[model samples]
Target: MVTFLAIFTAFLIGFLITPVLILVLKRLNLIDAPGGRKIHNGFIPSMGGISFVVGAIISVLTWFSMSQLIEIRFLLTAFGLMFLLGLRDDMVDISAWQKIGGQLIAACIVVVFGDIRFSSMYGFLGIYEIPDAVSYGISIFTIIALTNSFNLIDGLDGLAGSVSVVTFLFLGWWFMQAGMIGFSMFAFILVGGVISFLVFNWHPAKIFMGDTGSLSLGFALAVMTILFVDSNGNMNDYEGWKFSAPIASGIALLIIPIYDTCRIFTKRTMKGKSPLAADKSHIHHFMMRMGLRHDQVTITIVLINSFFIGMMFIGSNLNDHVLIPIIAVMAVILGLRLDVITLSRVKKIHRETPPILSLRERKKKASKPNVNKEILEKVNLTQN
Candidate 1:
């Protein structure tokens, strides 16, 4: 099928280009160094997002005709702008406001020109249809929030990429079954690239996708999510593929990042700090400090995400009012439990370990040299 071919083509391109991209990044010395809040060891080539983005775009153009492209032209334009914004930030750090301004511009293009704004709330809050102005405002906020939420979760090896792979795989399959070829192809192509990128981005990662990958990916996801909600709203239960709880299902698909973002932002605001202030208070950070390895944490989060999505399918017959409440309550309870466990365990660990011994152990580990074997292998692969 064309969808499978699109995925394979993108994967092959991404797989081939990533090693070469790594070599270029290393030569250019565009690498992410360890220290600060970052946990990786040694220098790792960054902006590796170029490989996957390029692969996905090329695959898209190859499989989808220009006439078909016109249907989503504005969305693709916004996607390009987002990719460029992130590429710029990864190369030269941009201010938070500047990055947000770019994201706003991209979101506006999608909402205003692409006409993909949400028209209804699906009666979750005893509200159904909304005013056009209100719908535009909500849609823009959703895009910006979703984009940043995803970008913030790219803190560990394979974390963002794995989550993205799952999100797109499900979205693409759903679209395909719904007979939306454009969205289906779009999702499938990106999945190919992300899956390929994961090879080099796994534990002991040779390359990081950097802001370029995360921002573009986040933007693409936001678009797909809106389309998913809007499309499903236009369909009825008799259609078989139509979900009775579109909004709730959408939340389940992206619950981890969205919930983590909300939790972290609330904590920062309560402490009188800027919401965007970088801190190790993210859920992944807590899991890591609780002694989980990078791969372990990534897999754990992925499985949790999978569980939520699976539940959405099983409860697809439920209305938004019932499904949304259940999802919200479950998320709140799980989040609170994580906070309790992390705080108590972290305090207990600190009490047990002497400060001097901890400092000495950290210093001993920092003094050692590390050249990631994965990077070395990729470098060699590119050369030969």
Candidate 2:
């Protein structure tokens, strides 16, 4: 009951303060303009993430039943590192490379000091065991991957923040069940903070979380479920209470972003493009291009993410074999949907361009001389 109250109170405080902060940022001209690939709007303050962070941090620190300073030294260090990195990027746009490097650095700090590492995947990949060195390497890479996955998913208003609220709630609950009360408190505090911010951050957003907020929030989430591995080198204990519940819940919480990342990488690589290259090809972008408005896109993705979370949770209770097939089916469905969105299809179709047109034929059309050139030339001549 106390936990619930803390979560509710934290969210209310955040929600209550978000509008005031947005107004302040707007008055100071620290607002984002509707330009480029960003959300369409005149200008909105992009500091909602900051407010959420502040609200959650203060709430937890002030009232959490944890130690005065911090129980885990490296945890605080890693968070501080991410907060600084995020705040800097938010203020002055940093390149993606820099962001990647920063996340890696923070992960390494935890790896070295806190010793949070993934020991195994409980035979998810059919590997029953792994070595310590292998465990550390895999865990660090996984942390970075998961951290960026959350950040990349923040392309639409309310999508990232709302999904996060759901994710953290599940994680916090799992933590409590596992007897890790401090961590559970952290998760609820996060949920409260983000929900509060989302009040003003919904569609027709008055403020954005910007990179500062997204990266920081992603960092916090990443640390919660990301760095911890099986610790043991066997799958026999993978289903242990602490291991299975936290692992399964964590994956479900993040399945949306992780699945999307994998889909994008595969699609891009198959098309002879670099996976790291950025384009408006994300799942959210495809839905928007399909004529979904900001709020609709936000609602659709949030609901889908929630569905996936529920499905994954169900799978977690079953055998690995059953879980694998379920995941494959979901992946196939998402892949087909993504394939339906293409430049050829999106182009204003003068006619029903064949669905299976070869690249050669497409390029041939590009190489062909414009038949309407004379008409355009005539029109230009008349205007002149």
Q: Estimate each model's TM-score.
A: 0.90, 0.80
Candidate 2 ranges with C-alpha deviation above 4 Å: 67-73, 227-250, 338-384
Estimate the overall C-alpha local distance difference test score of candidate 1.
0.91
Local accuracy by lDDT, each model: 0.91, 0.73
- Clashes within 3 Å, all models in order: 0, 4
TM-score of 2: 0.80
- lDDT of model 1 at position 70: 86
Q: In candidate 1, how many Å is residue 319 off?
A: 1.4
Clashes of 1: 0
- What overall lDDT, based on C-alpha atoms, would model 2 receive against the true structure? 0.73
Q: How many backbone clashes does candidate 2 have?
A: 4
- Tens-digit lDDT string for candidate 2 (1-384): 777777777787787788788878888888788777775667778867778777776776666664623544576678768878888887788888998899889998877667777656666657656788887788788788887888888888888998888778776776676555777787888888888887777887778888778877777777776633242223344333433443554555677788779878988999999998787778888877666678897887778778866775565556555655666577678658655754445664524456556767898999988778889899999999
